[model samples]
Target chain A: MCEILRLAFAAVFVLVVIITIPTKSMGADKEYGQYLSAECNACHAPSKKSGAGIPSLNGKPVPYLVSALLQYKNKSRKNAVMQMIAGRLDSEQINALAAYFSSLGK
Target chain B: MKKISRRQFTNAAALGLGALAIPNIAVGAKPKVVVVGGGAGGATAARYVAKDSKGAVDVTLIEASKRYYTCFYSNLYLGGLRNYGSIGHNYYGLAVNNGVNVVHDWAASVDAQNKRVKLASGSSVSYDRLILSPGIDFKYDSVPGYSAEVQSKMPHAWKSGTQTQLLKRQVLNMRKGGNFVIVPPTNPYRCPPGPYERVSMVAHLLKANNPKAKIIILDPKPKFSKQGLFMDGWERHYPGMIDWVDPGAHGGIKNVDGNKMEIKTDLDTFKADAASVIPAQKAGAIALAAGVNDGDWCPVNPNSMASKADSNIYVLGDASVAKSMPKSGFSANSQAKVAANAVRGELTGSKVFPARYSNTCWSLIATDDGIKVGASYKAGEKKIDVVSKFISKKGESAETRKTTYEESIDWYNGMTADMFS
Candidate 1:
């Protein structure tokens, strides 16, 4: 009985640490990403319904956004507006944006 | 395949309780931000700072008029494409929904050192940060013989209020086969493409109503924004009805007699039944009174939009000398966002991003015929320099032009919503 109780307590503590650590870091990243993404709302609509022709960034996969931004920075993407915007962002910013935008619902 | 036992589920639930142990960060007092001139710049700046700060900052907007008539699409109103009421926006939504204190009063002057503004009502308001977006005020003497007194006869409908209505009435009531003269101001005026767009709109109005009427453009600059597109549009839509005279061809405007409805140039004197003499422009009077102006405009840092004279005050829109950015509503709105972010970052513990700006000016020539010129900009050491630019070609498919026109309409709606709502 004593051994079982000790095992349950240890399992719960490990689980809480596992869940809380990533959540805290991601929460901070998402908040900063939101601040950085304000300018993007000028051209790219935040919602899917209003983003015809202009691509909607909300709820996209993180990898897809990272790839797209990288292409824009590398000049593989042909849009001048995206090129100008993406050229200013670094790798950390790109990851944060991807994480924040992907976390949203369409 | 594998199912969790009841004890495992109980352990997972117990783990979730530890997630709520994070302490809340303490923020002491609210910072106050005051914005003057509730146009595109002021309205957007106030809304963003208030909404994004999440009650961390108190924002107040001081505008002389309750109803703001945007000069962006007023030309379309004259062309009969848009109604007069469609271009006007109110501040009720900003006040009620966004928690912005909208004061309908004129900002008479600013005490930058002490960070207080004196209103026309004799009340003074203090602010931690001040945003001045007092759009352009015309230089009355820029065009000889044209002043406030003479505006009744030959209107300069640049401000988009009663002047716009008067100009529209004059255009509609022009005598048959009469000439309509448009005296475009020199460069560095509000809305570089605006005067030409007005010419296009007037041409459209005339072509439909009085087909025999002619339009003569007396321009100070040799070329104008979207010149190729406008020339193409005029030829395709209303050929032989428009005549453009550059400075080289017709010398500079010598004088104007509003009563006689005659404009004299070095080459010849032209008479018109109606005329729009858009005068040269300068920063709004309040900006000069605040002692933030270099000459006719206020200089600002491109990255932060902080006034060169005073760090506490930020100047936006046509009133500031933004080196590469054209003085348009879109540019103002863009600049407002940058300034708002910087201001919020300073007041709150929020993160700040590098400044990037963009603007697209759209013009409608005739029904479903539209063209646009746009550029994306980044902050340089000295100015906001353009990174890339695109313009509509002279000849494009009807479908493309139609799409561009529709896009402009959508943009107007979206931009107004962004500013006021």
Candidate 2:
């Protein structure tokens, strides 16, 4: 009986590990996506002009987006707006994000 | 290979382990968190979320610029004491050293109902939580006839980079005894003491070159940061070279004609060889599109800096209305840490931790003379309270000023490291 109990506990531990791993990944995807979007949402919207000052970012190309960011990162484009944003990204994440956004239709 | 029966395998595994299962089950689901603006506040939030949540929380940092230039100590560059390169830095440390996804792009708008952030490139990023720190935007209309086009003629030097450089050049080129006019904005602007610091540094330049040159400060407010000390320093150092005009004295400009280098104020009309007008400001344009900003600034909860207007969004720095915190670089840096930790707690379903913040602003009265103010703060029942505050004591000697200048360098390095490295 003791041996049987030990075996059950080990099996349960392994199961928990498997369950928690995916749980964390899913959480990251959702949460990271949420916070990252808030920054972007400030400028790109589908609705009409939110105000007199801001421009609409409803439809733009992925290549255009990628190029714009790259330029800011490279210092070819001199803008406080572009410089502030592009300075914070990595290559892989920028690519993945670029892919993610490019997939969306205007 | 022979496959063992599921029951047999389970029994074997349990016998080998022998300890309690301790499932440590996940309650519901992990939260999705996205952060915009990779400055002091945004970057700090990303670090906190990544650290506290273990691997449970996801953090994405979207910033528009590839590099960040700190406004603190930028005066040193203007004073010709340091190069601009000394103040510029990248976010590589935040990306490689820390496990963070830093995206370079302008966040166009947030769809609150759908929980989606649309990018300028027609791409949509969905998140359960969003953080925005879009910083400040200049209100062009605040000063009549002052627009982007007129910037070449009369540099604001308010923001960093080219405009700042342009203003510096114009000052350097001015003939001996040329007039330098600095227009200070009304209440609620970024870097309250910045204009005065600029004046002080400019006075140093004139003293070194054209001793006959003079500086005129047109202030909208009656009082300024370290007014007593600044005035005292002026009397001792650049006596009669510095002058001030309050709004009531007809110094406030009603309109600006940039082309002709003329300004018409309520009380007087004047023209100068060089001028700087720091105008009224509001949250960056992006904040308005996200429906986060009211009229002037974004309203956010003091604890987490989450937008009060929207549950999914957070705002920080000069853009957000963190009522207790001043709009200074150091304040922005400290607030970022609080916001980051709060974001981590929310994502992992854990308790949000209380935040204690600190800030110090150092200003140069001359090339060597420096003055500073600092404070520590914590959350009260509903607001933030200053627990401790200090200023440089009476009679700062040359050695102390030199130390302060060196300390300024160290502070800038540490601050950049905290944000990126």
Clash counts per candidate, in order, are 0, 46
DockQ of each: 0.20, 0.02
Error of 1 at A42 (Å): 3.1
| lDDT per residue as tens, model 1, B1-421 | 1112522443444344222212222334467799998988899899889988888788999999989999999999999999999999999989998999999999999988889999999999998789999999989899898899888888989898889999999999999999999999887988999998899999999999998999999998999989988988999999999999999988999999998999999989999988999999999999999999999999999998989999889999999999899999989989999999878766664555668788888889999998888887889999999977778887788988887787777677667777887
Which residue pairs of candidate 1 clash?
Answer: none
The numbered model that scores best in lDDT is 1
- Each prediction's RMSD over C-alphas, in Å, is 8.6, 16.3
Once fitted onto the true fold, the runs of candidate 1 whose alpha carbons sit more than 4 angstroms away are: A1-28, A43-106, B1-28
- How far residue B257's Cα lies from its native spot in candidate 1, in Å, is 1.6
- State candidate 1's TM-score: 0.85
What is candidate 2's lDDT per residue for B73-164, written digit by digit as tens?
66667777778887777878877877778888888888888988888778877776787777788888888888988878788877777777
Q: Which candidate achieves the best TM-score against the true structure?
A: 1
Model 1 misses residue B107 by how many Å?
0.2
Residue B159 local lDDT, model 1 = 91
